[model samples]
Target: MKQRGIWPDEFTFAPLLKACANLEDLEMGQGVHKHVLALGFGRFGSIRIGIVELYSGCGRMMEAKKVFDEMPHRDVILWNLMVKGYSQSGNVDMGLGLFRQMGERTVVSWNLMISLLAQNGREKEALALFHEMRNGEFEPDEATVVTVLPVCAQLGELDLGRWIHSYAKSKGLYPNLVSVGNALVDFFGKSGDLETAITIFNDMPRKNVVSWNAAISNCAFNGKGELGVQLFDEMLDEGVRPNDSTYVGAFACCAHAGLVQRGGDLFDSMIANHDIEPTIEHYGCMVDLLGRGGCLKEAHKLVETMTMEPNAAIWGALVSACRTHGEMELAEYALKELIKLESWNSGNYVLLSNIYADRGKWEDVEKVRVLMSGNSIKKAPGQSTIV
Candidate 1:
């Protein structure tokens, strides 16, 4: 169109800019912005929104702000976009500020900030926001229900969660929106209401891979590994494609049940039958199972040959097994690896020192004490609070 000397309209630029935003193609977006301005299309709200979306989506909040401030009229959608962009960048305060500044807020706006707070560990604030939203004109929607259920669960507000569950059912959110169902299942599962969680899962009008993952994983979370494994098999039979989380849940269940042989078979099936490469979580679960079952030699071999670096959790598991099995040398090695990862955590030094002392290795214990002294590390108390 440009080659033919035909000018592009806001309709043409809207999707183009949106595509740039989605792709994170800031340079292309900038080029489009320049073209939009040159064509005197900047006055159009659609054009302005597209430009803002492009800048904000690329994490260039400053540029997005410049465009946003220049717009004489900003809709809820544009304001929500800014909030969401800041939220994605982990600037929750900025997102909150934007949200508060909005003269009018939509459910999407409330959901964005609520979800942001919930995800960033501000569960209390997120729950507060949900209550605040309840008093407002924009009642809780599907997204609001999904976001708040977990917060209620985390804070042990079981009664509140039950209320939300009822609200979801009354609002017709439960079965229609699979996400709401998934969230309800997860909330109940985490709260140790396995029977209710399963009932909700079974009653959902539809189920997806995520729904299945939640059901299986929750069983694992509650140490119902046998049931979780059964759910995994049931999922496979139902033709749901299993992803990495599915395997993680399955392995965790087997590990919890001390079903080493079944875990090994599932791991083999993941690789051979499903073409799913085991992730660190899968590997960690296998190591945990092996260690718990006294398969130290095999766990050590698996760790040594892992394609990725074994995280501190894996080394910590090995250290635990070494302690249980009286493998002092392996304990030292695992403790050393853990120390390298988190030198600030004083538990590692304390544990290693205790092990050395138990074996009458006074010299090694002395070295560990000296090391702790040099690093100014101290043992943690039984519990601590920020206050």
Candidate 2:
């Protein structure tokens, strides 16, 4: 603009700075900031916000804080931006500090705090905050419903999730808002209410691929692979084209039920019919399916011939199958692959030791114990929960 003899005015720098922020181009953002200072727009509220946003988006929370502190006066909006920056950058403590300091909290502020807590695995705290928000006279909005619903799902808080569903209905949220409806289905399915989940799915005014995927996976999770297969067939009949996730749900069904031929045919169809290239996850599922079906040689051959590098999940599945069938030689081979893939993971080592012990190979078990001690590898203690 300068070269073209067009002088940049105050309004000019605001959009330019915003562009830099959106692109997360800190170098260009800094250059724009320098230009804003040179043009006497450094004190501009909009420009400062843009600068804060740019630094924050790039994960430079300290720089964002600096720009924020330099402002002549801070408003709730600016404070919210800073809170978001700290939260997203994994500085949850700093975010909580700023949130606590806010004089007036908007719905967005509450949602951000709740989401931040949930993101950091503080689900119970997030739910508590949601209760607090309600006590403070703030009605749950769509964003609040979307944010807190996942927390309910995670904790298996069926009563809370049902209340949220009721609230959404009261507010006329579901059926129109597909996301909330989908989340409801997922929450119900995960909370061991597959019947309710399927009912919700069937009653949805409109259904997307996600709806089908969730319903199918819900059935697969409860050892209803045949029902999952039925769901997939129905999904196809409904013309909802399946994605990788869809295939994954279908393959999971095959694995649990040991439907080897169906899994193999579906694996072929993924490429031949759908044109969706197989990801490592897809390969892992196929390996698991073959292994669980007792076709150890075929499973091993699949892993060895995979175009992508075989991951631990693929090898681990084989090891598990070998352990089940007492295929000592195959178990050893799977253990080798597992160790090669994840040398630090002590679960596979312990599994191999157990396999040897089960076969009365005390020398091999002792060798495994020595290797573990020499490498400083320790198996994580197992924990059982009644719930």
| Count of residue pairs whose backbone atoms collide, per candidate | 0, 0
lDDT of 2 by residue, 113-144 (tens): 99999999989989998999999999888889
- Candidate 1, residues 1-387, lDDT tens digits: the string is 889998777789999999999999999999999998788888989888999899888989999999999888899999998998898888989999989999998788898899999889999999888888888867788888988998998999999999999988898987899999999999999999999999999999799999999999999999999999999999999899999999999988998998998998998999999998888888898899888888988889999989899999999999998889888888888899999998998888888888777778888888887888889987689632111
Q: Which stretches of candidate 2 lie above 4 Å from their native place?
A: 1-3, 354-370, 378-387
Evaluated against the true structure, the overall lDDT of model 1 is 0.90
The per-prediction CA RMSD against the true structure, in angstroms, equals 3.3, 3.7
Model 1 spans with C-alpha error above 4 angstroms: 1-6, 373-387
TM-score of each: 0.93, 0.91
CA lDDT, candidate 1, residue 374 = 89
Clash number for candidate 2: 0
